[model samples]
Target: MKNIKLYQVFLALLGLIAILLTISLFIPEEGIRVFGMNLKFPTIGRLMHPKKQETAEIDNIIVDVDTTFADPLLQHQNGSNGDMGAPNAGELSVKNSTIIHLNDAGLVNLHNFFEKLSSAATAKKKVHILHYGDSQIEGDRMTGFIRERLQNQFGGNGPGLVPANNVYNTFAFVQTYSPNFKRYTCFGGDKLNSRKYGVMGSAARFTREYKDSAEIANETSIKTGWIELAASGSAFGRSRSFSTVKMYYNSCIKPCAINVYENGALIHQDSLKADGKSHIFKLTFPGTPGKLKFEFSTAISPTISNFTLEGDYGVQMSNIGMRGSSGTIFGSMDRGVVAEAMNDLGVELIIMQYGGNSVPFFKDSASVRNYASYFKGQLNSLKSMRPSAAIVVIGPSDMSRMVDGIYETYPFLPYCVEQMKKVSMEAGAGYWDLYGAMGGKNSMPAWVNKGLAGNDYIHFSNGGARVAAQLFYDALIAEYVKWSGKGE
Candidate 1:
């Protein structure tokens, strides 16, 4: 009697399993309607046996291509460089939807930039390309590749325009600072009490905080804060060369002495002003130095605005990265100081790539449009500062959100991309669709599957970043090909 009862229970369970398998075969692949409620049906194999979740392994796919030689494509010509071929970045290239040129003028501003680029090697001054972005480029990911390619195509060297106190460990250059240097930013930090943050939207100070004279007296002994930079051997060839270094600072109310060392030998020394005004200290080397160090000794530390490393001539692509910025904090900075920096650097092109930070919080298309509207004002303000400079806006790449236990593209990413393109053209700036180039809807998952993106589904892994940068470079060159009448 017990054996008979057990056999009956086993038969019942097998019957139920057979029924589920039959139902799954007829249901839509996406899901099925059950009891008037949309439900996803599992595959027979999935129902029978579950697959384990696996994380993508971070691979060293980036080859660090030598960017020291000029690209044959960048050679100047009247038009028709034979068959204008598409750009190749080793593995991937831009296809189908190239960079969007919204207006009839298209990339006229950028075309003018190309004129300077063609003659960059012989230009009287170095032409700068300021690539401002958020954490996507915080460690100089996409921007570093873009810089490498451009410098290779044009004639340039060194990583341009680095923050004095970098929060991210960037491969472009290795920077280390003394602990006394306190970081402050215009975007988000404890109130700085001064709105003098420069174009980069941040500054660092070595002075100790004071509550009264007692605090100052207690720390009267002169303390020193130093920042040292050396060419990172892991970086690409061009990024490893630095012949010119410029330091921007302000708010020095006390005499501060600056000593610069090249390869551990004291090369230059100078004293800073006691007046509270913006100042620039330039140190140029006749040849590339293996390492460079700046040591400052003072009773009070001056606000160190920023630092720049560059070649004497050619295109200098500066990665002006802010960790959590949405490309909307430029207006909060000192306009005069920003203008000064722009002019002093001889900036001719500005590439503003953002929107990732705002993706998750965006409510709807209207919200995205509103954000773009505010962003338009910032672009206009930048134009006012550098009237001749061309601005290009790079839309955010595809970010994913977990839906029904699967990572899928955020619903409104395309809407945000369109809105940004519309406003960018309205502001007389060029636009690039990073999302579209990355394989439109539901593409982040594929990138992750290929080990090109991170497991977080938000940031691109090193391999993914290199691919995106290459696509962007290819798109830019394609537009230039058309603008220059090189391709029919």
Candidate 2:
């Protein structure tokens, strides 16, 4: 009797397992939601979905992105220009049609800003360009190259902005900080209760809140926040030196002492005001310095927003690269802080490169459209803060996903790029097709094969970043050349 009952129980367990396997086979591969709640079924769905490719060979796949893909706007041109004498301000290139696509409305409005950048060196003025992007630019990959090239062409020095408590070990500049500093960003992790993340969508502090002066004095805690910046030996000569260093900080309740050291020698010591308003501390070196360090000693840690190292004149391109951001957090940051930073830096142009982070999560057409609309709002917010700053939106680059053990371009990447271009144009911003520049569909696999991209088929390697940056710089120069002719 006991043996018979044991056999029945074993059979029941097997039956339950079989039922679960059957349910897994029917679950959505892309995931599903009922009444706005995610079904959390991807783990189960993977048991059956994305059927593994049998005898798949990556080399067998032939990818010719340039031949098959062209920007949608190319068709709309309709041979509008009767005579293509010299490429006009917003004319499509007759050779490749990869030049910056200027919305007629935006070009007319931003004509002066472009002219200002073109004349920055001659005018002996500091023109700032904020290149904001997602993980594609993490560690200043694309932006650093662009900065090096532009500074070599125009006139500038030093890596523009270095964030406090940097998550990515950047090659643009060598930065070391104490481990006590906590990183707070608008997008992820343990965010601050105040939500006062700066323009970079992040800030770092030694403590989360204000501490009583007596308590701080009595406290023997060794927790302190400090950062050091020196020229990375590998960086270009132009970016390896700086004439000025400006630190941006806020949210200090008690006066805190800040120490500045130059080449390990104490240069200056000062105390910050207890006032909670944004503040800028400027230190001008006698000439381009090789190294500088900042040590903050306070019981209550103030939010150290960012630091800018720049030259006396020429174009200053700040690489405000935020990892894993969708470029949508600008709306949530403190507008006052953003406005102050924009005006102080005199940002004349804003180049936003995003959408690669949004590729995998897009479920359908509605998702793409919604993302476009959402991104447009962020652009509008930036415009409102810096009305004089001309905006250029670089659409998503080609990204890949493995399906059936074969890596191919995401099915809707091209669609997402087109929608982004439309909304950017509608929002009175110029659009650049990074996707097309990279050779379009399935180009990531090609880039990976060439060692220009990572094995993940997402982010670019250093060489790939240089290539992308050059393409963008070339497109930008093409427009500037036409604008420069007018000045001549």
Candidate 3:
């Protein structure tokens, strides 16, 4: 009788295991809602196929940066003598800090943009560099450092293009917008059905989207909105001084009254054109104002794309940070609106830093390749939109995830990096291996321990961002110096 009871217990345990497996297989990552509460179970993907573990816990990490990739191309452009030849010992040493990979055509594109950046002051025109990335660059973290360095090296001033809503409120400037404004973005949140997100991938408006012309026609109540910009005490010296502000807007069927104020006194006022087309409203100041305010009143709010804070001449880098994006939304955006904005802004280079957000969910080699394919499409679209601008893709950095109580680099991260690099170069864009720059495998734990990165092991802290940005900037300048010397 006791033996029979033991056999029955074993059968019951097996049935329980089968039921749990079935439930786990059906459960998604976001979990399910049960009785107004989120109920979650161990996912079958994680339970069945566990992440591959590292050899051992990393104790001492030595970062070895490969510099050969920095000078990947030496094309004889514009009567330069160096054509696919070896760089000298001095040049190699100067480029030791960079891990940039560029092909022949990419190098040419870089050189052309370098020429424009170098002569911006002499030409009396601003050369814009649009820096687009995920949350890794939000609030102008790395972009701020890069901007300061670029402005100091080349001649430029101001904080570059800022969004109309001023959501991030970067350290470069203090901004505040009224409560009436509503923001629409291309990457996340409630996206616009019109797909008209401009260069910043976002726009602001006081009125909600109207379904038909009748709704817009019936809207007669006038709405008032305002945005204010103030100088930041902690801002870089160059960003603190700007002589001009250009507001980019579109889709206006009614005349909007705009008033610009410096401090408490009204400085300039104008009415927006009633035409429903893209336009730029320019405002120049004799000197830096203490507080700049822009107030608008209209029955229907027009789409405000962005506002430029720049000088008359020099390099201007715009920080466009889109959170939770893998940089794949450009193909869905309005190409014409983006191209128009790019042309108006005098864009010479576009720097795309992405792939971190996709690192965690990458399941296998095929998944990595699939993402790369989609990413390539986005790059191709940008290239088509702005053929004259140089494009560079900064691959994802070292991101870690917890597996069996130990935080280690994601299993497929290295392979994803490899695929992203291949796709970027194939798309006629330069590639920067951020993973290698961050010291490769199992590096995030050390960074987290040092407090350079967040405990999440994905995003970098402010200090770490500066370090990362410096690595990129150093590599860029080193390559430029080599190219400039070759031209001479």
Pull out the clashing pairs in model 2.
none
Once superposed on the true structure, which residue ranges of model 1 sit more than 4 Å away at CA? 1-97, 208-221
1 against 3, candidate with superior TM-score = 3
lDDT digits (tens) for residues 398-449 of candidate 3: 9887755678888899999999999988888889887887778887777777
For TM-score, candidate 2 versus 3, the one ahead is: 3
Candidate 2 C-alpha lDDT tens digits along 91-154 = 3232223677877877865676777765766666777889999989888788887776566666
Reference-based lDDT, each prediction = 0.77, 0.76, 0.80
The Cα RMSD in angstroms, rounded to one decimal, for candidate 1 relative to the true structure is: 8.0
Output the better candidate (2/3) by lDDT: 3
lDDT of 1 by residue, 1-488 (tens): 44668878999999998998898767775786779988887776665665544332222222332223344433222322221112212322223235656575546788888788767665435789999988888788888888878776666777888788888778888888888788888777743555667778888888743436566545556779999888787776677766778899877766789998877999889998767788899876655666778999988778888898876667788887788889898777888888888899889999999999998989888899899999999999999989989999999988988854767678888899889999999998999998877777777777788877898988889878888787778778777666656665
Q: Model 2 scores what on Cα lDDT?
A: 0.76
How displaced is residue 338 in candidate 1, in Å?
1.0
Whole-model alpha-carbon lDDT for candidate 3:
0.80
Model 1: ten consecutive residues of lowest lDDT: 80-89
